[model samples]
Target chain A: MAANSRFAVAAHVLSLLHIHEGGRITSEYIAGSVNTNPVVVRRIMGMLNKAGLVQTSPGVAGATLARPIDEITLLDVYRAVQPEDGSLFAIHDNPNPDCRVGRNIQVTLDTAFTRAQQAMERELAGMTMEEVCLDIVNRP
Target chain B: MAANSRFAVAAHVLSLLHIHEGGRITSEYIAGSVNTNPVVVRRIMGMLNKAGLVQTSPGVAGATLARPIDEITLLDVYRAVQPEDGSLFAIHDNPNPDCRVGRNIQVTLDTAFTRAQQAMERELAGMTMEEVCLDIVNRP
Candidate 1:
């Protein structure tokens, strides 16, 4: 399966908005930096907008951060662009109920996978867009 | 993107081998419990074999774990079945070099993402197939 890059693109879009605060940053301009299509940037930006991370006027080329950079966690950005299900791992569907292991495996695996996913999310939650922007600015 | 169910299937397969220990657990039998095809079971078993997690004989219908269930962690099973790249998140490719954030974003995201992935892996590493088996056996 192809790796999902929506999280990465969303992060780039947000970083650009934060760094260029008070400026009109368009999808086309963000696309230039991401080296992808403006449509792709707009699509991700739409998710951010829906998540209330950014505000965009109808037919406008630019958007503004709805929350301060420090308040927006990477976890928030990840969830915004991720599918609504938002599970980091996928469980198989429909194991046979006749089999003991099959009957119980889903619940068993769910417990473990949830723990692992939460561990990752906790890390993302601890990190903010402010930290990301600071790292970008400090880069040589 | 479709949710990747390989991890769940692999865990289910391994649990069967453990629960039905001392029995010749064929791919067909495993498939019945997983509610998948024998071909799917064999394909995952092939990966486990290659990862040294299981031992399979040519033209054989069954296989055995390479180590005790207590010695095998979910992280081991996860890595065995995961794509070689194994990154949970993907970064956008080919950002413009002319853009400062673009040039630096990859590295910045890498550090943060790696931490999150490792956090999840560490959680997986802490939990063993033994724990999973116990959970399965204890289920009501």
Candidate 2:
């Protein structure tokens, strides 16, 4: 799950929180909604909370989006789950730099990945959980 | 892996093809550029070719971007590799559809995913393979 899917999970949780629209919800309930383990839900919440997207409380408490659902973008959720590892699309480790193409491929891939991620972020930037909530309401 | 990195691999390959600038390179070479196995490279290439993002040759052959890399965006590469399976984010399969929150989460997720992917494409629309290649040449 280290591959950046928490965005999906985070969005799901946030949508639920938005639906609740008032108070915190337990990880157990959220996990039930997700059909995943409570630990999984809590872990995702932890990540989201660390990124300032959500706030968590212990004991008789659960989690809530730090801001309005519409204020949160997919990118915000993504940043919360990203491991300290590196870029979203870093090149392979220790490429065969001996080869002419391999030697320089990193540079090219970096630029491409950068552009791709920028594109992704830009795309994500245009949206908020509010739009998603609207669609959910409109769904047949 | 059926995870996020797969897209990174596809983007890496397409970015390399764009850098090749229409030069015919074998899958082995593409894999080499990606630092992954050639078989895996060929497999992904086969998918890309099928998606019309690339053209491949049979028997000891390589692949080339079907569209100019500039005309292509990160979304194009992602589509070629993954075929837009389901949603961009994974939600629980057995959500409590009975509950208002669980019932509508999928629709919300879909809308969010669509907007996010579109924003990513629009941002990517600002770049071209030529810029990616030039960045490679200029990188320290």
Candidate 3:
């Protein structure tokens, strides 16, 4: 159960599209750039497509960005691939109810964890695909 | 891996110690509350001990918190078990260097991820074990 690498992979796929905007790129090409399999790249792309961050057509073998890179924040990309109800941290289910602390731990942690999630989202919102591409292109 | 439950598990171990202040508790007991194996509890406790958040006597049978619950923030617990130099998000290594995006993705992602990590730490810093335990105790 490794931390899902989908987010990293999604970002990489997006970066490649940004670098090669208007170019018809297949999942195989994206997979090669990401150094992962085409299936993984396609899965992430599927999520990205559902989120309307990217566009794909049935019978079409290529993909493209649905919006300008500057308009697409990391937060948007993160949410695009993130599990709808999953938290950054998960409280273990079914703690011993006989124990007072166990009986109440989940609720307690849920509140704090929500705050932590919001904090991370705020940071992600501050970064966009355009800035990421600029940083990469400007690197020596 | 599996989103690293160390933070939640560590908090559980601490809350139990707070509820049973001055009482000697074994890893097996904590494991029972955590619904996991004693080995896992011991591993997490070892981290807490190394962080100076908890005290363990060599050859002794149990452990306890080293500081007041209020003084032990979630940040302390997190740092105690977090992999040093690990980021919340990891950029894929060896992205196709021939591609401009691949050449610079790591550096750009690293900068953005670092900010996200700091934000999470800041939020964790604001929460203490005392607050956590109080919330649990006060729950209906």
Candidate 4:
């Protein structure tokens, strides 16, 4: 429930771009599709623009992927929108360090999360945004 | 920085059990080791015990795994502690369902998350908790 908004936002934005690949689509239109405020879309666009995943224009303009959708994996979009985290999971801090187990709880968690995320990324790396979009298009 | 605490607690508790195997341990001690309240340990213990991952008792009691440490994969621990997920990645709610992508993002995201999580579990299944513990015990 608490994963984060960036991944979702990135997906939404990419889907919007896929729908309007040739024509420049305004953030307002994208936000309308996402049901979120245009300002939020714009903010995320600014970050993606900085990350070079997207090319943006000023005033009533929209953004599009700097590269082809076929070349972008979910991991590419994820990394562009979300910072690289070693593990997909995070450890709860303030563990009882006084106890031996507490002292190593974070350590153990780090290992598990890191391994799990690496596994997830390896799988995700196999698919491109085109594949995702194609799947959506072909869906019944 | 955003990860769940469930696995953290489970792994810590399990590691402690392995460290002090053959000896009964109490939730209070486990909680102390996890740096959480005894109540928290007790709650987790209830589930772990049900999953046959651990055993527990009343007063002057602690918990231990039902089987040897080598038999428990991280996947076993994860399944034991996974909480109810309201949404996979917290995609925008109230999205314009009339929009094609909006109508489909949820479905697509859920599928992707499922696949990603499966890949993660497969990876976790490859290693035992013993490997994790040894890494720690042997850590310099």
Candidates in order: C-alpha RMSD to true structure: 1.2, 4.2, 2.2, 2.8
Candidate 1 residues lying further than 4 Å off, grouped into runs, are: none
Work out the iRMS of candidate 1: 0.8
Q: Which pairs clash in the backbone of model 2?
A: A119-B120, A123-B119, A123-B120
TM-score of 4: 0.86
Could you give the CAPRI-style class of model 3?
Answer: medium
- The ten-residue window of minimal lDDT in model 4 chain B covers B83-92
Which segments of candidate 4 are over 4 A away from where they belong?
A: A1-5, A83-86, A92-108, B1-3, B86-88
Q: Could you tell me the lDDT of residue B93 within candidate 4?
A: 76
Ordered by TM-score, highest first, the candidates read: 1, 3, 4, 2
Candidate 4: residue B22 Cα off by (Å): 2.7
lDDT tens digits by residue: candidate 4, A1-140: 34577777777788789778888888888899888888988888887788788888787485768988888888777677775543555566787666656666677668767878788888778777887787777765
What is model 2's native contact fraction? 0.48
The per-residue C-alpha lDDT of model 3 at residue B21 equals 81
Ranking by DockQ: 1, 3, 4, 2
What lDDT, from 0 to 1, does candidate 1 have?
0.92
lDDT per residue as tens, model 3, B37-71: 88998898899999999998866756878998999
TM-score of chain A of 3: 0.90
Scoring model 3 with DockQ, what do you get?
Answer: 0.67
In angstroms, give how far residue A92 of model 2 lies from its true place. Answer: 2.8
Q: How many residue pairs clash in each candidate?
A: 0, 3, 0, 5
Candidate 2, residues A1-140, lDDT tens digits: the string is 42345666777787777878676678888888777798988888888878898777777565666887778877777677767553654456555565555566566666666765676677777777787777766765
Off by over 4 Å in 2: A1-5, A21-24, A62-65, A68-70, A84-90, A130-140, B1-36, B51-78, B83-87, B123-140
Error of 4 at A129 (Å): 0.8
Candidate 3 TM-score, true structure as reference: 0.91
lDDT (C-alpha) at residue B121 in model 3: 85
What does the lDDT read for residue B106 in candidate 3?
Answer: 77
